[model samples]
Target: MLAIETKQLSKSFWKNNVVKQIDLQVEKGEILGFLGRNGAGKSTFINMLTGILPPSSGSYALLGVQGPNNAVKKEIGVMPDYSSLYGSMTALKHLRYLSEVSGKKVSQSRAMDVLQLVGLEAHANKKAGKFSFGMKKKLAIAQAIVHDPQLIFLDEPTSGLDAESVIQIHRLIQRLHQQGKTIFMTSHNLDEVEKICSRIAIMKDGKIRRVGTMDELRAYYQSTITVTMKHAPIAATDLATLEPWLKQVGAQLEMEASHFTIQVESEQKIAEIIRALGSYKIDIYRVDVDEPSLEEIFLEE
Candidate 1:
């Protein structure tokens, strides 16, 4: 089943089109990484999906129910990019109030369970206003999932977390996914999305520029292979011998002490270069090939 679907979804404010025609879908039990640069309409699209902002034109459905319908509202949870907890209330109290508002009839035990799940149980009695930024973010996420919604939308869930807290949050998200929950999250952190998302939609200028698995995107952006080799230090005379071989393969080489970095079109060229180097009886210690990161691909666009 599709957990979420949109067709020609769009939104406008005043005379500006914030979100242009966008078509997207998320399958049940899948993590869809909604990626884009700032002002690229990621948040606007997310808002439309959650019904926080009505689409100017187009259609959408959440968990099989058409939009502007409240039937599936209870089945979806949303954690926005910004924290939205009541500062004056204690963490426990805030969760209780939200539970009542959600009409979930949750008990203190349930609230505590969620707090612990988010690693905030120790601060349950502390006023939310006194909590640190990371703690507040955790509290917000806990509140979003207290009802055990079938699908969850998390926008920059790790935005303010410390390194340890970020790892903890990633693990928690993975556990939720394991339990058959579908997650649609927006993030500017490419590394985080690469680690957690099954598929990604890259947006730019209010439109989806590309959508695919990480491997697929990487293949699309594949450039020359970067090969770094650790070899014995070279002299002016030895360098002349390497120059002819480098010219033969049309490879560019950079040298620093005992290291040589070569850029070649493919692995076959690397093998040829290695063979040429071997003919010179030069010893090679290591060879490393660097591939383009998702950030590289996004920036290139």
Candidate 2:
């Protein structure tokens, strides 16, 4: 069964339609990244799925159970905002309380394990009011997974974190994915999404504008393929041999002292270009293929 499935799901606030008819499916064991600009209704979409807000229309299912019902809530975890943390409660107390509140109480040992998983074990006794913003974020994650839910929703999991903390959270996320937990996460960090997510969905003005793997997204744009080759400088006379070969293939080459780059319509031309270079006795050191980045693709239109 799909981890998440939505058909024509929508939400409206007053006369303003916030989340349009969005049809999205997230396979079990997949890490799907949801990307969008500010006020893209991402939070509202998540809130509706997590049972915070009711959708204005349409339907969604989580893990084969039609929800946002109690059964589905039990099988899923939502990362809460740091502000929701009780100022008087210690980190350990927080997890234990949340676990009980979710109707899936865990032992103190398991609670500590969750704390350690988020690198907050040392501060287990520290009250939430004394925790740093990053620490609270960690606690928030710890709260999300303490009950071992099958699916998780993380909103900007690494936002406002230090470099080390960000890396820690990335590793934690990868570890969770490795454990076969389906993750539906939203982030403005395109590079992080590109590196970590299996597929991505982009939202704009309450509508899903695009959704696919990186390669699929690139193909949607029909991006130009840039091939960069690092090689020993070719003799001027060898240009006579290579230039015509490039033109014959409808490729444009820009030469430098020791490296050259070529732009082609498709990736199929790369192999032929390499063979032609080898035939011309060009000593190739390295070759790099370039495509449009997620940032570049997100910015278009």
Which stretches of candidate 2 lie above 4 Å from their native place?
none
The digit string of per-residue lDDT tens for model 2 on 56-135 reads 99999999988767967777889944346899999999999988988999999999998998899999999999999899
Q: Estimate each model's TM-score.
A: 0.86, 0.95
At residue 51, give the lDDT of candidate 2.
Answer: 89
Q: List the residue pairs that clash in candidate 1.
A: none
lDDT of all predictions, in order shown? Answer: 0.86, 0.89
Worst 10 residues of 2 by lDDT: 75-84
RMSD (Cα, Å) of model 2: 1.6
- Please identify model 1 stretches exceeding 4 Å from their true place: 232-243, 255-257, 271-283
